[model samples]
Target: MSETADTLFSHVKPEQTGYVSGGLRDFFLYRDLGVAAATQGKVIAHLVKANMAPEKGTGWHRHEAEFQIVIMLKGWARFMYDDQETLVEAGDCVHQRPGIKHFLFDYSPDMEYLEIVSPADFKTIDVEPVCPIPDPTPWN
Candidate 1:
């Protein structure tokens, strides 16, 4: 095997993960899975959780990565992918191609998901909302 390939391997247990305040937003938490280090910043794997409060979620934004995917692991979330509203629940998977406009409007208190993206650090460019959206339902 190539030395680069051999250097890019990671294994993480659920119990070994710890959540930290997501720098992008205060209403979310993130758990890194060592993918950045193993892949030499080529990829990042993380678990993201919605905090237990109703707040304007990640507004319309797009990633600067070449590839991105999200797999829901708990609860549900409502998102606006471009102009269409999408409901993502447990076991649902979403592949967000680079530059796809999306808005994460709201989510359940127990919402958690796995997100993998190319490049350990990706730029998120915020855009104006282009669709009518309902007021977020408060978390209990």
Candidate 2:
């Protein structure tokens, strides 16, 4: 059997698969975009939506990957990138540098975003905070 170049083609419809638990975070739901298999584990793409209100948020941690980007699709989110407080809202994109320690402290209830990362399997290691994080605003 010969493999064709079109074998890499991948199309995922929103109705095909629904969000499920057991993702990297418990407070969020993930929807796989089938990019990892199409790219042969070279990359992974998925949509993450908020499942619960942000409380403690993702502690200071850095991923062990070469590239990572988060595109906010709905609502808004607040994160601490190193010593800076970065607020990413809809229509905003964040290209997190390799191994940059950060914390996602808060977000809206309808928050949803697209996340693409190099290497399907990446490790997240918790690290010490570079600066104090501000308190999360109460969700109305």
Q: TM per model? A: 0.91, 0.93
Task: Report residue 6 deviation for candidate 1 (angstroms).
Answer: 6.9
Off by over 4 Å in 2: 1-7
What would the TM-score be for candidate 2 when compared with the true structure?
0.93
lDDT of 1 by residue, 1-140 (tens): 44656356679887888899955678889998999889888888898998657577778888899999999999988988999999999999999979999988888989999999998789999888778776777865
Instruction: Write out the backbone clash pairs for model 1.
Output: none
**Which is the leading candidate under TM-score?**
2
Measured on C-alpha atoms, candidate 2 has an lDDT of: 0.94
Clashes of each: 0, 0
